[model samples]
Target chain A: MLTEERHQLIRDQLAADGKVLAGELASRFGVSEDTVRRDLRELAKAGQLRRVYGGAVASAPFAAATLSQRSRHAVEEKTRLARAAVGLLSAGQSLFIDGGTTNEAIARAIPRDMELTIATNSLGVASALVDRPLVELIMLGGRYVPNLGTCVGADTLAAVAQFGADLFFLGSCGLDVARGVTAFDSAEAEVKRAMVKNSAGIAIAVTNDKLATAAPYRVAGADAIRHLVVERTAPAATLADFQSQGAQVHFA
Target chain B: MLTEERHQLIRDQLAADGKVLAGELASRFGVSEDTVRRDLRELAKAGQLRRVYGGAVASAPFAAATLSQRSRHAVEEKTRLARAAVGLLSAGQSLFIDGGTTNEAIARAIPRDMELTIATNSLGVASALVDRPLVELIMLGGRYVPNLGTCVGADTLAAVAQFGADLFFLGSCGLDVARGVTAFDSAEAEVKRAMVKNSAGIAIAVTNDKLATAAPYRVAGADAIRHLVVERTAPAATLADFQSQGAQVHFA
Candidate 1:
């Protein structure tokens, strides 16, 4: 196979299986493992996949905004959105919190006496909830992807699927009425999808600028999210766009 | 079975069942409950197993073993032991680090350039590793018990069993030849036991006072551990006892 053709097949295998073993690919193409490994390395450098011990995982979301990156993007807007998101919770609720700056802020703003059970895949979120004795914390196990944070690999996805929660506090890289809810990382997207699948309701806390943007991996449609939380700075038209998609939009 | 072997089997029973009755253990060993109680007492003194009414609940060396507590106990000694423990590690190794003051110190003392895969149950240890860019951190998931400061329950135990590491750094409340490797909490004991089961080798970092004292939970026997790391202040005879039990003692 041509090198480019082989690369395409490798990417296709990754997209389908979420992973590609170099040894298995080598036999299929009748090529040396070294050649296959080199292909994986190139793909990794090009932001196409992540190389693991014996294989490669699909690349993380290419969106430049990391959790810490998003933290400094829009300060007041995120805080307002976070406080608004916290208001949605009752005295007792079990929530699956995704990893993101807005979500970390929301975790920090959690009321002390809420008597809540929070299950999070984010190491930062878990750290934030440490001193809050009243809250029961469940840390989800998974492969830790540096910078992007903890990912819901197979173990995490299975754990999330087997459990049910009262609500899901969804965080997103992009949320457009037309494109729906999207994330940068595929494993993260898969985890969010599972959280939505297992929870009774889904509430997304989004910044104003992220409203009309789109990321590579789609988690769900904007309409599938029961509640859309946005800062008051969000334009009226953008809020209308989300509300028209059947979401109950809340402006902080 | 030898007396030490009997102690080990009883400890295993404690691990698998989460508790062991003195009467039942007595009958199982063809001894009276009084003899069983003596065995339990010895194990309890070594912090191998906690003594409770009737039989024993898991040992929860509750009084002085919190991560913060240990940090204050032996500053210089723990630091020296931690540095030596890091020296035992090669650049590309993976490790399962249990939760303890000394263990957290060791995690912090980890060289920044040693590319490692660290799986840990301690929130403090995970937090220490956060800014480290090269290390791949895997936070073990489970129900977070507040005071213990780590995840421990069925989930953590199951997760430990499913994973393997290059090395296991077993932390304990006490380490003595007579009592073996011991911890304060039963689940911690069980998790440490699993770490030993999953890793290629086991190395323990202990302080001077922890040398002769024993906690309630027994994690392993002296022969089972390949390396015993200690502070220079540890007494010569105590070090000899561990050496006699088949551990290579390193005084940092």
Candidate 2:
């Protein structure tokens, strides 16, 4: 068969079978395995399929903005805050992580050697630790909202109530001395409230954009939060205001 | 040297060091590199090993829950059935998904644009669909089982019975005509029983391994399942046995 024909056939098989193994394809098509591997290599380069150890599998398009979208916003600032957050955690400690880009960064920043039991409502946070053999993850169940990838509703609150966490890393859409920490979505706000109530300590991670802005749904008052992590660009006046409200402000 | 002799030696070399170099093999066999390459090529063609840049490596280094190891077990066939399973879902439809490798593939196979309400007891499933804004996820809560990464016990079964799903994708540890559907763990089997009872349509996703193997605990009778998805490698007699039991058999 022609090389082009072989390529077309591989694509067809991949679409039908979810993968094409080099060995199976080689004997069936009367070609060298090298040739088959070469075809898989070319197909992988064309973004038709993802190459595995012995084969190539059909893949979902990179349409869902999971990593790039989260990492793109406030890359340097989030990294700094994540480093600071990890400093607070020890080898054997349990914590609660609410869903958001900032919280996702903190989960990623966790040291590999640390053995912690992390209870989370965020799908993103759970996935980040799946392969980490030492880290035990307890996922809170609830009515899931897709874009934010968080579990909320009554069930999520009930799940949160079950866990008595040492610390809570809360992500907020808006953080202010007057309005406290806020969220744009009501369901997410509800989950955040549970995270704050169930944990012994609350730390809010926010960028400078959220400093003065107040979102519609209020998660907690300023006094509920113990630590405020902000970017260096945050206004000095706002920092003083948060500190005055009994929040220990930490600049990333 | 004989072809079978060369094959056996190659297998031994691979078992010891995990790889076989083309140049070293040619010199050891006192044959041209082309001859050695041809032998390696045939081994690759037989699925005994995977051809690499300078040599061949052991076909599957399966040990962990990493993505590559998960994809090695009849991935093409599983993916094919997973694609078919997602076709049964529609917008606003609620479904129950149990935890297992086949069920994980089904979760990954969901179209990015399809808007469906997904209720799952699988951490893998929840994570796969987390970034999808259109699909809503409801995670079932229970005692977390690390190896399975699933929720089970009274809480999980209670969670299962609460939802009247349009469909339920049940993952089976074993399947047969006489023994029916079975799971290795008693907790998983209990949860599967609830899923089968609660959903309108029951579909069991199985690779070829589970076709005739019956485990200790029974999840459901063969008559209870509406659809049985199996790989093409599934024996014709086994397929007929399942069909005779009133299930609509689908070969991926």
Candidate 3:
């Protein structure tokens, strides 16, 4: 069969089966395993599939966002929020940061000199923080959420509630006057609520565009957050309105 | 600090700063950039740090049990359990297996030709099955639990609930006459419960040693399982007792 045909067949198989293995594909197509591997690699590079250790998995079905694609959205705002969030952290503090693109950026911005005990639900954040000597990472074991790249459940919620962190960096799906901070998934919302309740301070890291949006799950009301860190300036009237509702608004 | 002390200081600095840019560390230590890179390489080899794209960061912390160490515990029993579990599977049958050493073996035992839909919470199982073509694999995403080598959470539970599988291959931390199947972690217990509820048949894979013991978190009762696949032949009387309770017991 032509190489294009083989690749198309593989894609079809994955769409039908959710995953495709190398050896099975090799024999089915009457090609060597090496050829199949190469095909998978090319398909992965082209954003057609995700190449795992020995095969390929359909890209996350819910989000439909690649790692790079998710990374690009609101990059500047995430960076600014990360910078501001990092400023609140001091040496010898224990912190919990929810998993999201913004929190991942904050994890990267953490200075190496700062000593911290971090408990996180986000695999991306945990993996990023792994290389830091001064940071003692406690990964809360729970159900893995592929789309969010984190873990959440009753056990994760219970684990987070037991620790009182000095700071909690939270990411939201949407922030609005009515919903306050909301998440796309209910499990994630539960985790965020637990983090806020367990931490000494709650800071919401949001990009400018998320300011007026509302998702399905409401994590907490505007009155619950201690700080709102955003990129650039929010409307002065809106900032005052939030401040009046007991939020300390900070423009990065 | 003296020059020798300065080298130590730089090492300390690297520990404090996850990564040290050659120019930045050199400027801070009054050493050449080449010297900083060499220092990083040395630390990397010592397993104290990792070299990144442009600099160095601390290495990922080593867990107590290496992958190979943990793989040794239930080898014989897992092999037997895996074989028995595979016997229950046929073409186009969807299966859910929880993460454990036994399930890892079952993942390896799956025949490549019997078209199957396998869903799992274990990264090891997913990676092992990656070479099998006829087996459709779906990974249940949650927080990566290092000890269990899988993800767990509400999302993980939700993901598992999305499909009704023909069979479930489960690994238990302990099993008792009364408490039934238990797990070391509560979050895992929750995920296992969902797995059991969604599958048509449940097979408990236990090493001889884990039989009759009970862990902290109870996943299900002995009566809930359809089969008990173990490494060794249990006492005939014990087998009879279990059989009376509605479990079809098999010696691996």
Candidate 4:
């Protein structure tokens, strides 16, 4: 059989069984375990599967990657942006923090001594602030979308409407000068839009990669961003565009 | 200074400042870094402090140790009891799962294919069920207590009242035939009491060590427990007492 045949069969097996053991594959295909391992490694590198101890499991669906997977990308950049974004907040202000790894980082970077009232639809954000004594946390109730680690649906939107926050830390999937802020999922975008509408001010911290990009659902207009935080590596022209819209741009 | 005196000073410093650096302590006390390390190790062994890389932090307050700290105790026993308790559950039933390490274990052990509606106030339990496709999760919102990994206050109690569940997985701090199921914190106990009231059946899964013991706040009476899951090593008399209260007992 061709090498492609083996790889194709492996992918099919993983899709059907959720995982595939290298030894079992080797025995079934009359190939060496080393060949199976090589195939698994290649598949993992291509993002087709996740290799484990002696096998591989199917990769998370790309459209809604798990929170843990999303957290693993651009970690240091996210932390830098998060720290810069959290610094923009004043003490004693009530805020709505959205879901995303960057937002989760901002939740952690919040000063221990600062007092705040934080309402969130993000499980990770709530978990991060639970230890701090000065922060009063209110979690919004709804259907939990595990991959995004945020609540959604009509219940979540209704809960988000009840609170008019001083600020909203928007979780950005894609941001564009012309297209405004957007999210990958429609339900998430709707919830974000509610947050944008309910808060007096809005802030978003994004890595350079997200700039000038647009996801499917538009969350708000560029002018809606009161405070925009980006890494120093972001294009100067892009920064100027945001600044022209009256956003106070800060670089991490 | 004598070793005991150094240990005392270390405790004082930790209490005053919340943390103590080994190098700073050694220099201040005219001792070697190794001596400070030894002191920190001893204190950590005694549960008086938590040792970090270069220093020691004050131990969590005993009255409200963090949930992470509590989860470290009796891990294997809890897993066993959790598995046994989860076995008593059926598909298509709605459950109210409370907060505690054992209850968190039960949440993790829930069958992925079973369709269930779960309402919980536990950060840990919600986190565990988020990835499961068949579980419809509802997070009860309130003031998040970091130590307990649970929400409390009036909001939590009010939220609990809205749900009528087929089963309540009680997070047991202590259980006794005379005192019934109890919790270390009064607020947590109140939430547990509310869960007990809203559910048709109550289940308590406990390690043998928790049997016949009592905490400060009473959650419910012995007869309230519809299902009791205990380790096989529990005292026969105690098991009989639970059985006599019309509770169906299962052993892990």
Q: Candidate 1 lDDT, tens digit per residue, A52-164?
A: 88888654321123322444446556767888998889977898998886787688778767899999888767766765778888888777776666656877786687667
What's the best-to-worst order under DockQ?
2, 4, 1, 3
What does DockQ give for each predicted structure?
0.16, 0.27, 0.06, 0.20
Which CAPRI category fits model 1?
incorrect
Candidate 3 accuracy as TM-score: 0.47
Question: Candidate 3, which segments miss by more than 4 Å at Cα?
Answer: A1-73, B1-252
Deviation in Å, model 3, residue B212 alpha carbon? 29
Give per-model TM-scores.
0.72, 0.74, 0.47, 0.74
Q: Candidate 1: how large is its RMSD?
A: 19.9
lDDT of 2 by residue, B1-252 (tens): 998899999999999976788899989999888988898889888878866657776664211232332323456667787987776678888888988767877888888898888899887777666667788778887656766768787767766766788888988888888888888898888888888888898888787777889999998888888888777777999888778878888767
lDDT by residue for model 3 (A48-147), tens: 4678877887543211332335444455566677888788778999888888877877887799688888888775576455446677666664555556
TM-score of 4: 0.74
Q: Which stretches of candidate 1 lie over 4 Å from their true place?
A: A1-73, B1-73
Off by over 4 Å in 2: A1-73, B1-66, B70-73, B87-92, B112-115, B131-134, B153-155
lDDT string for model 4 (B34-73, tens) is: 9899778865643346788889875443213322344444
Error of 4 at B33 (Å): 26
Give model 1's DockQ, 2 decimals. Answer: 0.16
What pairs collide in candidate 4?
A: none
- The window of 10 residues in a row where model 4 chain A has the poorest summed lDDT is A62-71
